[model samples]
Target: MEEKLSKEKIVQAAFQLLRENPELEKLSMRKVAQKLNIQAPAIYWHVENKQALLQSMAEEIENHFVAPKPKENWKETIYAYMENYYELYQQYPCAIEIEIQTIPSYPSRLRNLDAILGILNEAGFSIELSYMTITSLQHLLFGMLMDSSEEKKLYNKVMAGDDYLKKQIILMKQYVQEHELKNISESIQYRQKEKQKDFFMKTLRVFLNGLDTFV
Candidate 1:
């Protein structure tokens, strides 16, 4: 007997395609249908269009996120939540891109956002401040992941004997040294020596510490 087609099945298929390709633009209903051995029009019955499919895929990703339990200190709760969130994003290909293209209207996404904001509110933050805090943290996570993704691509090219990027890095370092830009030079060296996960945690701690004064 043929299996039933449902939103969940469609989303899973689409996500599978995304995992294989890791390029959002390359995902199409036709392709998804091909994967499922169904006609392209069948997907429209569930997803409406590509944008909706993307939103569904994003929600599917969010559904896997395991938020930290509430802590005595709200900062501890937030820190743990962020750490988990970063790892969740790392598990999926093009996860950040899927998130960037979707609205946070899905049940899972809203629940997570509400929980974080509620923690901030209970910690004596104004609604506006809580919103800003969550937004800023998201920006940090997304920006860092996006940068890491691009860096990985560049690293691959460098590994493939791409001298242009290597030369650019050398030129920048030489220019910094010649100009005696001590701070920039030192920061570059420090970043090179630090693991990305360690850097993220250090930055997260710094941000939370700064927020301590405001609370």
Candidate 2:
């Protein structure tokens, strides 16, 4: 007997496969079908191709992200919203990569964006500025998250007896120490290797404070 494959089921299988193997470069629809014990044609019936499959996987991951309830302090609410997805993307490693590669019109994601814009609009920002501000914040966050992931990978490599990180850090410290700029060397020594969530929260606070000047 052939297994019945609904679009929802296909998306779910694809998500599970991604969770197991997060590299988008290696993902395939046939792999997803294998995970579901179904034929590739079955998956293709619901999702047309690889791009569609990736978008479907993105949709499935966004299913867990909730737009925060409205709060009296909309800035705080917006921070909370971005922080939630930031952390969610950290969990779903393929999330940002897929999001970067595809334009997924996932409903929940759109609602979250709308809610963020709503917060800014309520806080007296014009619609145009609100859009720019939110996108700018998102761009900053994408950079940070990508950096954090790279940092984690490097740290893991160091743990695995790779002296490449050891050498690189030593060289970095040497360069900082040699830099004659007053206090720059000292600041480098005290650099923060903060957990990503805490780091982003503090960064977001500073960013929001800066936005106040625009009001």
Candidate 3:
């Protein structure tokens, strides 16, 4: 007797694989099948294709993004929603890439986007502006998280000792001198931690201010 394959089982296996793997670079149906000790053909019985499997994984992540209910104050609601999304992505780094590529037409993803738009609409943004605001907010949050993770790695190294940063700074200065670069201070200032936070915060404030203009 042939056993009936289960879609839920395949999705669970895929999710487990994603969680265990730090890099989602090799997320393939073959790898999933290897994890489940099943043939790739058997996986096809459940997931239509690799894209469909990724879509399913994306839908699950969107569920997390939309879990928070709309709040009394629009700004507060949006702040919390963005915070929730950032926390989720931080927990599942793969989510950053997944959210970037997933189609908004999918039911769960659409519902999440609609929820965000609903908040902006309640805040008195026009329909078109609300759409723009929602996407901008998402991109801003994702960009910050991604940039922070990358910078933090370098930051840890630099903080490890003055000698490390000195060596790198000396190399950079030599490169700049050889290149006859102007505004080395400006370049260094831009890369400084204080400047990075100020830029991120200022960008968020500007976005919120623009949202205010829509009101």
- TM-score (all chains, Cα) for each model: 0.89, 0.84, 0.71
Q: Write the per-residue lDDT of candidate 3 for residues 1-215, one digit (tens) a residue.
A: 95456776776677788777645667888988887787889888778987788777777766666457766788768766766676667656467777676665578777767777877776788888787777788789878877776676577767887687769878988898888777875667576646544566567767776666558
How would the candidate models be sorted by TM-score, starting from the highest? 1, 2, 3
Candidate of highest lDDT? 1
Score candidate 1 by TM-score against the native.
0.89
Cα TM-score of candidate 2? 0.84
Candidate 1's residue-wise lDDT over 1-215, tens digit each? Answer: 98899999998898888778777889889999999999999889999999998898888889999988887799999999999999999988889998998898999999988889989999999988898899899999999999998898788888898999889878988899899999998898898999998899889989988997788
* Local distance difference test values of all predictions, in order: 0.90, 0.79, 0.73
RMSD per model, one decimal = 2.1, 2.7, 5.4
| Prediction 2 global C-alpha lDDT | 0.79
Off by over 4 Å in 3: 1-5, 69-72, 149-170, 173-206
Identify the runs in model 1 with alpha carbons over 4 angstroms from their true place: 161-163, 173-182
Best-fitting candidate, scored by TM-score: 1
Candidate 1 backbone collisions, by pair: none
- Residue 29 lDDT in candidate 2: 85
